[model samples]
Target chain A: MGHYWQEISALTMRWVRRLSREKFSMLFTLVQPMLFWLIFFGNLFQRAADTQVMQAPNYISFLAAGVVVMTVLNNGLAGGVDLLFDKENGFLERLMSTPIHRTSVILSRFIFVMAITSMQVLVILGVAYLFGVQPATGILGVAMILLIGMMFGVGLTAISMAMAFSVKSHGDFFSVLGFLSLPMIFLSSALVPLTAMPGWMSVLAQFNPMTWAIDAVRPLILSGWTEALPHVGMVVLVMIVFDALCLYGGAKAFRRAMG
Target chain B: MDRTIAIDVSHLSKTYDSYRAVDDLSFQVYAGEIFGLLGPNGAGKSTTLRTLITLLHPTSGTATVMGHDTVRDADKVRTLIGYVPQERAIDRFLTGREHLQLLGALYHLTKEEAAKRIAELLKLVELEAHADRPAKTYSGGMKRKLDIACGLLPDPKVLFLDEPTLGLDVQSRLRIWEYVRMLKARGMTIVMTTNYLDEADQLCDRLAIIDGGKIKTLGSPVELKIALGGDIVSLTLKETGRISSLESDLTGRPAIKTVRATPKGLDIRVESPEKALPAILESANRLGCNIEFIQYNRPRLDDVFIAHTGRAITESIPESETV
Candidate 1:
């Protein structure tokens, strides 16, 4: 329990794999995004080609990158709501009585949720690959992008968990998720690029963490890492800062939850 | 607080602005005893348990388990104790075997060790027949057994059970009681908290009767009953309204120290009901109160509780404390 990274990783792995075995939520996490990629983006892209002033590239690839970020954000955003069920069942109290490492308990959950989301991203990419699209970067870039994306995902996860600890039941967490998730996704570059949105929306996107992640990964996926350094550095910096801050907030919130 | 005891709690109080959930509570659970903390709902039993278990920080005091401070050495405490929380905690999606194995692995058991422990716990809770089925498919009793199995996965030295058989069927409750007895025989120290009075009466070695965040009394059941002073007389009244007026009239009578209206009839607490019966009958004949049924029985825990708290054991209900 003292140095819990390995144990946390193992636990996280188990939880993530367990998600695949679960039905309702797992379906939402894995398949729902795929449908969004196909239907919503497909409809919008059909009309984008007719705009004579600007070129809309292969809309599917454009949408796939968004799906990756969306998956991470969605996964991160949903992490703590599950704890509500744990509270209801009394498992949270049971775990607290154990001699397990506290850090492992917190970090392992984030690692696991993000890990499952990463698998979902892979599935999206796999299907995207079948449609004649390729990641502009190779395995290394994809892995690094994922790593960064995951770290940011952890930050968002911390925020959600912090919120969950303050709420009494799962019902409250579900409603709060809407208030947190939609704004972050919309304000970020999930559905469209910053330039494509209205002026005020672009300005709002500038401050959005999801927008930062989307900008960081889109170039890496669309044109590979060789195309930008400053952009990548900015996203990485934002992710790390938020990751540290949110974790601290989460730990504080978790400690308070016991009261 | 000395940091050497297996479980030490001191002046622990928690307040929610105005609610005052737990107030200056203190207790110690040593190495090996099936200690029961008995109380009614919202008597802060689970809050006290949670604070000792290191799930919550005390607003004022401190608790240490296994010679490690709950606040400073929570991870160590987590490694040392197995807790069966009050609410039934189980993932319906996971199989019994898988859930046990997953929990075992979390405790850093080698795959072999995890499997072995899982196997033992499954059989111990009598879930060996359905080890491979998902917990969702389980009956409430089966799920409850599996929940207990999950707690046993780590083989903890001190087991903390918070209402282990709550909401279980009679048969399942019997089986779980048997399992709990077996656990105690293995020399494990268990600290059990229950709002249900009977569970404590049946399962505990020694009980602490808690009310309104304070220990009202602590002793073996027999000792507590004996200390309550005398045998009880219960009587059913032909009519309840006839007794109250005559109760005060009988109190100063030869054999009567006090008179109480019981569900059975008008009961007279006395030194000798048999010797004083004719005098009581003469007095009652003057007052004209008829009795339906009557019996003399030994005092029970509920009576003891009433004597001390001046309230019925079953009343004054508060919400189930969500730990």
Candidate 2:
């Protein structure tokens, strides 16, 4: 049991070290969401998006939650590219031939991806603060937003990791990633609220776990604890079920690939 | 040499769907000897090593390492073996020191033990000066050395090297051979696979020549060569059409044991080349076969491969599509 955690920590630290060395990827990961989505897109749609419909003082404040969840979504979805590279380069095969616990490989990836997602989420929130968008629920609400983002991230990362193991190559994994992420972002209340969408699109958005996550976090940023708490419970429930399914499928894929 | 067995594989077969990558193969590797699996690509050499290392389970039959079953006691088997695959497995982002540290941790080495071992391996592979640099900056030979260092992190009893010197330059190949020899001197059992005939002849204590997922022959390099009987007299005829006539004429000669026709020549095995040479020349002259070149020397591993498989080891066998 002790060896299990030690192996996980060692593997996790490898990911952290690799990320730290990639100056461009690290800088891009933290800055892209703030520059394009938050500042440019937020200002572009600022006057057009009605504050009353968005249920906030301004579009920037409403878009903060969307950006946070979207960062988590993007980070979570692309989490497995490193593992895929390892598989191709024969690093994973080297790891498997060792005496370490098999589950350590999967668990270490989860821990590393979530840690990076949290850092990105914090950076997005800090940038949104520059736009005069403060969380109405204060520091605890900031914590809750990160919590919700992580909850949403768990299932997405699981699915991504599964695809990393299941697919033949990185190209195949990216194609599936693009197909899943674009439709998911458009279908949710990420860029636009559900009420403003066409009836069919709004109904589809209701089924997106990203919608549940964004809805839960939007209230925390725009409304106080009382309004946000109920939405948090529903999102938490949805994430638990979502994560269970993803993890189950991911385990199966891992077993097949490992064999 | 101690005769205790380190690895025992019996009737081990691994199949992917209908394709049998490893046919019903069996062999044993004794402790503290460098055993070679000599074969071309896709001859099931890598597959066999992977199975013994517990990376792949045998489809049928069984393999044991240090008395632990490969499938059932895989964890125990892993603790006793280290594998250096053909592919370079180093992380481009991590320094040489970091790669060893991480692998040491995974092998469950204590902090101090890992540090000591890592330092030793770095020096052994002569990467101490460049240990702080990421692998991407290292040359191909350096990357391969780091890979070997990682595999040695666990201080395993047996080391499995899959084509260890496969694309290395002559200097790098010699360095790797020195390291492998040094390991064998420490009484570590080593199993390596290679398609290089010279590598097998120079390094292997005993080797199995495999082809099409089967062991065609097995013995020490010298033994396999000497088994072909006397010296080899290679005669390349100027006229290709006269090779068969010359071969037939040379067959009944007194000192000649076997006469095999080659692409451009006839390879004649003679009990004594000194006596057979003159007679062979007479036969060629009688047959009116114009000789382009003639040479005689002791048999080599390539000749042994030819004797067994009816083709030289250097002859390209179309690689199997399945990995």
Candidate 3:
């Protein structure tokens, strides 16, 4: 466990170094999703107030849960790209050649990416707060939302890393980003309520881990976690399943890649 | 067992499909020695190094670094060895100090140890002035220097430098050579690979002439040159089409040991270039082939490459093997 912590700290240091240089570019990745939240959530909730879909006074508060989840998910999925890039650049080769444990390299990325997601959620939430979006609950609710988001991020990142090794994508950064981001955002409850969707879509939302994460934190952020245990439990269950599947995929892909 | 051997490999082999990249290749690099792998492209120089660094597992064989097994004990071996790859591995986003410190932490150094080592490495690579600058802003030489510093972070026992001066200017290349020598002076064991004949000649204490996944010969560079018999007097046929045919005309000459035509010209390595040049000139005119130029110089590592692999080192790599 101490070794694991060492790897995590080292990995976080590398990310900070990398992000620190592309200082302005990182803002683009962090801010672009929030902009979507503002433009889509602010206008959509205003239109939905007359409809039966939005029961809350300000739908943007309900929307904050989704924004937090999506931000964490996208960041986590792309966090896998860090490992992919290292593989491409021969950094992984350099590391592998050293005395460092193979598992440490993979674990470090997982820990660091989760940390980064935590920070990113804070930044996004701060922005949302400025737009008059506030969680009705205290610090614990916010921490629960971020923790659940981190869990989802880990699962998504594992899968992306698996894909990165199995198939080499030639598309540039934004192309890959656009290819992955929109489908995931639409499929989950990030944009609309699960009940607002058709019966089939609600079933899909139940299976979508993003939907579980949003539903887990939405009531907690708007009403409080005392009322959101069921959603939180569901999210936790989905995360465990997804984490296992993704870790399996990542490990298999890693064997094939390292060979 | 006493750390006398910096590297030891027994029956090391790696194969890709029917093509064998390294075929039961084996050799040893002793402590505080600058050992060289001398070969042309496709001679499996990189493959051998990759295996030692635990980047690739040997298909069959045992490789140990500083008495640590490269395969079964890869994690421990990884911490003990510093590998400088053929290509650059610096992260452009990080400054020199940050990059070294990050990698230092990965090696599990304490905070104070990491800081001290980062400062020491930056100074060792002569990048102390540029330590705080982002690597993206560094010049090619500066980047390479910083990269070498990053490799030295853990105070590794055995350092693997694969083609260190590959694409740099002459001055920077020499600078790298000087640094490697300095490391050796400090009692660091180093293994280096190079296709350049002169680099190996100037630096390697002992070298293995690798070709076609096999070690054709291994010895000190001077001894290898002497074993290669003195000088190479190469004949360039005026007509390129007849280059291959010239070999048949000059096959049984007493002065010439071997004759072959490469992309460069007709290369002939022989025992006595003084006698072979006169006979070669007489034979070329007799065969109705005009000689463009005939130059005789002492046998270089390039001739050793040709003698071993029958291939030139500088020929562009095929598209599939570009990386």
Candidate 4:
């Protein structure tokens, strides 16, 4: 068990170090969503500051949580790109040839993705704070935001990794990414509130896991724990179920791949 | 030398959907000897190796590494073997030292033990000076050396090297040969695969030449060469018209066993090139076929392959097709 933990940490550090070495890419991944919220969405919804439709003092504050979750969504969903490349380059084959604990490979990937997701969440929140959008739950709100990101991120990362093995090539994986990325983002309340969306789309958002995460996070940033904690608890439950299913399938796919 | 078998793969078969990659393959690699799987691309060399290494499950059959069944006791087999895959597996971001340490940790080596072993391996592969640099900066040879070091980190009893020197230059290939020799000296059992005939000829103590998912022949290089019975006497005819008559004349001679015609010449296998030379020339002269060129050569692994398969082991497959 001790050896297992050490191997996991070692492999996790490998991913972390690889990401850190590419400073520009790491920074870009964290900053891309923040840029969208601050420059594009912030200006696009500048008039929403005077509107009562938004629950915050400024649109950026309301959009802040959404941007944080988006980072998690994008980064976590694309986490398996590394796995795909590793498989293609035969690096994964080499790793499997060793006598080490096999689960450590997938576990370390999850840890690495979560670690990056956490950093991206921080960056988006920090950038939003710089734009004068303060979370009503304060520093504790930052923790809540991270919790929301991770809860949502783990399930997505697991599915991504699973798909990385199940799919035939990068083209197939990218198509799935393309097909799912927009729907998950737009179908959720990332760019708009459920009330603002049409009746049919709003109904769809209700079932989208992204909506539950955004709904859970929005209250902490805009309203407070009074509104957020209940949703957070519910999202945690949903994520537990979601992660169990995804990780089980991911492990199955991983075993087939190793064989 | 321990004559005990380090690896015994019996009637191993691996199939993928409709394609059978390996078929009823049986071979034993003795401990501390460098055994080669000689074959062209797609001949199941990698599949057989993968099955033994537990990377791929065999559709049917059993392989034992140091007496542990590969399928049932895969973990035990893994602990006893290290594999250097055909493809280069080094991460570009990690320095050579980091790669070695990471593998060491995977094998559950202590930090002190990993460090000491990494130092020793770095020296063994002659990459000590470049061990701290990122592997991406190293030349092709350095990357391959680091890969070998990674495989050796566990100090396994058997090491599987799949096409270890495939894309290396002559000098780098020779350097790897030295490393292989050194490993053999230290009593490590090594199994390597290659499509290069000369590589198998020079490196392996014994080789199994696989073609079309079966071992065409298996023996030491010298033994296989000797199995061909005699030297190959090649004669280039000036005119192609009388070649058939000359071939018939040589075929009837007691000294010649087989005759084959190439685009440039005719090759006649004889028990003794020196003894058969006079009869071969006399037969050609009697048939009025002018001999443009004549040469006597020892039988090679290639000849052995041609003898069994009726075709030369061609080396013209481009790299892209290998994937």
Candidate 5:
């Protein structure tokens, strides 16, 4: 067990060091979504949007939760590209040939991606504050939002990792990623409220785990604790089921690739 | 020689779908010796080495390293071996020191032990000056040295190097060869694969020449070369088409053991080149085959490869079949 922890920390630290060295990538990854989606898109839609129908004080406040969840989704889904590159470059093979526990490889990647996602979440929230968005439940509400984002991220990261192991090449992984992310974001209550969406799109959004996550977080950011807790419970249940399936699929792919 | 076997492979084969990458190959490496798998690309050299290191399971039969079965006791086998794969494996963002530190941690070395070992290895591979630089900043030779240093982190009983100098320049290749020799001097058993005949001939104590997923021959470099019996007198004729006619004339000569025709000449294998050269020239003269050049030398590893597989090691194998 001690050895396992040592190996995981060592591997995780490698990711941390690599990220720290990539100053340009780190800057863009943190700033891009906040710049385009939260500020520009929020202000653009602010005048056009029906705040009464959407049930929010303003569009920027409403878009804050969406941007937070979307950051998690985007960062989580793209997490496994590094692992896939390792496989292609033969670093994964070298790691497997060592005496360390094989599970350490997967677990370390999860830790690194999640840690980075949490930091990005905090940065996005800090920027949203400048736009006059605040969680109705205050600091505790912010913590709950982070918990929900992480829960949603767990499943997305698993699916990404499974795709990384199962696909023949990075090109194939990216194609599948593009196909999944756009539809998922558009189909969910991410950019728009479910009440405003078309009847058919709303029905599809009901099935999206992203919609459940966004609906849960929107209330905490725009409404108070009373309205947010029940949705939180529902999103938790959805996350449980979603993560179970993704983790099962991910484990199978990992075995096929590593075994 | 202690002669205790370091690795024993018996009827080991690995197949990918219908294509057999390794075909019932078997050989043994004795303790404290450098063993080479000599072959061309796609000859299953890497497959054989990967299996023995417990990276790939054998499709049939078995392999053991230091008395541990490769598949059944893979973890035990891993602790005892180090592998430097054919492809360069390095994190471009990590410094050379960081790479070794990470490997040390993975290998479960204590902080003090890892530090001591990493310092020793950095000096051994002569990378102490460049240890602080990220691998992306290092030259090809430096990256390779870091890779070799990573493999040596555990101070393994056996080291596996697959094409250690595949893409390096001549100076880098020579430097790597020196490091390999230095490792051998410390009494570690090493298994390496290479398509370069000179690498096998000059570096290996014993080698297996593989072709088409099979071991065509196995012996020490000197033994394999000497097994061809006597010397070779190669006569390059000015006229190419009259080789068969001259071949028949020299076939039954008492001094010559065998006559094999090459693209430019006839390679006459003889018990004594002194006695056979005159007879070979006489036959070509009588046959109106004008000799353009004459070369004579003792049998080399390439001749050994030709004698077994009937082709030089440089002949191409289809790219798709390479592992």
Candidate 6:
């Protein structure tokens, strides 16, 4: 068991080390979410909603949770690109030929995604704070934000990895990724509140796991723990089920692809 | 003087949906020998190697490497063997030393052990100078050498090189041959697959000629060549009509072992072409056959393959693709 974790951590550190070496790409990943927050949401929605009615002191605090979730979503979706390229270039075949535990491959990818996602979330949250958006729950709120982001990210990363193994090429993988990422974002409350959307779309948002993650995280950032725990519990439960299903499905798809 | 079997594959067959890639294949590789799975593309050479390395599951049958079943005890089998895939498997973002250290750790080597092994491997492959540079900066031959070094990091008892020199230049290929020889001298068992007849003949201690998912023949290079007898005799006749009678006349002669009809001539396997040629001519003359040209020469691995399979090895494989 100790050795298994050693392999998983070694492989995870490999990705993290690679990520750190690509300074331009690493900066781009964190900067892209901040750009969306500053330009796409901040400038556009500066005076669109009332702070009192929206249940927040300001729009930036409300939007901060969304940016955090979006970072998780983007990182999770992009997580499988490495796996797909590995498969294409035969690196996966080399890794599989070793005596290492098979699940460690998928586990390492998830850990890498969560680590990068956590870093991006910190950068986004720190920028949001500097712009005068403070989480009501303070330091604890950051922990909740990371936990929620990771739970939601793990499931999506699993699905993305499953797609990576099943698809034939990067073209096909990106096509499916493009088709899923935007709709999941728009359908959820990432860029807008569920109440602001049309009735049917709002109901759909209620079922979106991203919505559960954001709704849970929004209160932690804006209204404090008093009103956040119940929603947080529900999101945690939903994420557990989601992670379980995706992990099982991903492992099965991976085994079939190996065959 | 006792040799143990390193790999034992029996009644192995793997079918991809409707196509049977490996069909009822069986063979044994002895410990401490370089074994070659010699075949053209898609002849099931890669399929067999993949199964033994635990990359592909056999549809039916058993493959045991180092006494561990590949399917039932795949992890054990994996621990004993290293595999260099047909395609390059290095991470362009990682340095050659980094790749080695990571792979060594994945194989459960301690950090210090991994570092020492990485250093030794870098030196062994002669990549010590460029070990710190990213693999993307390396040339094709350099990348291939790094790949082999990565495979060897674990000090596995058996190493599988799947067409290790497939696309390499002559110099790089010879360099790889030297590495293989050095590994074998250290008592490591090696299994390699190749379509190049000379690679199999020159590098392997034993070779298996696989075609259409079966082992057509198996032996050392000299044994296989010897199997075709001492020499090959080719006689072209002026009259193609007398081929059958001339073929039968040469068959079962005192010195001629076997006679095969070629498009323009009769090819005979003989103990001594000098002794067999005149008697063959006299018999053919009695049968009203006129010889236009005649040539005698030593047999080659290609001739051995042809004799066993009824067509030249490369001819049976379509020209459009070699895989």
Query: If scored against the real structure, what TM-score would every candidate get?
Result: 0.82, 0.89, 0.82, 0.88, 0.90, 0.88
Chain B structural similarity (TM-score) per candidate = 0.77, 0.81, 0.77, 0.81, 0.82, 0.80
Between candidates 1 and 4, the one scoring higher on lDDT is: 4
Docking class of 1: medium
- Indicate the worst ten consecutive residues by lDDT in candidate 3 chain B: B314-323
* TM-score, cand. 1: 0.82
Residue range with the least summed lDDT across 10 consecutive positions in model 6 chain A? A37-46
Candidate 6 chain B: 10-residue stretch with minimal lDDT: B314-323
lDDT of 5 by residue, B31-137 (tens): 89999999988899988988988878888999999999999999999999998978889999999999999999999999999999999999989999999988999
Candidate 1 docking DockQ? 0.51
Candidate 2 reaches a DockQ of 0.72
Q: Write the per-residue lDDT of candidate 3 for residues A1-259, one digit (tens) a residue.
A: 6765776677667877677678797788777877877546665666555434744557677677888888887887687777767777777787666555567777777777788788878887788788777776778778887878878888887877776666565255446767878777787787688778788877876777788888888787777767788888887988999889988988999888886
* Per-model tally of clashing residue pairs: 11, 0, 4, 0, 0, 0
Can you write out model 6's per-residue Cα lDDT over A1-259, one digit (the tens) per residue?
9889988988998898788789899888879988876546875786987766566766777788888888888889888899999999899999999999888888899888998899888888888878888888989889988999999999889899999999978999999999988898899987778887899999998888899999999898888898999989999999999989988988888989998
lDDT score for candidate 6 against the true structure = 0.88
Off by over 4 Å in 4: A48-50, B233-294, B315-323
Model 4 residue A178 distance off true place after TM-score fit, in angstroms: 2.9
lDDT of 3 at A173: 44
**Candidate-wise lDDT, in order:** 0.75, 0.91, 0.80, 0.86, 0.91, 0.88
**lDDT by residue for model 4 over A155-211, one digit each (tens)?**
899889999999999999999999999898899988788888899999999988888
lDDT of 6 by residue, B1-323 (tens): 56899999999999987778899999999999999998878889999999999989999999999999999899998889998988989888899988998888789988899988888999999999999999989999999999999889889999999999989999999999999999999999999999888898889999999988899999999899978677888889998888888897778988888899998889898887678888987897788888899888887788877877677756757643233
lDDT of 3 at B276: 82
Per-residue lDDT of A59-94 in model 5, one digit per residue for the tens? Answer: 899888889989999999998999999989888888
Error of 1 at B145 (Å): 2.2
lDDT of 1 by residue, A117-142 (tens): 78877887787777665888878767
Per-candidate DockQ versus the true complex? 0.51, 0.72, 0.56, 0.70, 0.65, 0.78
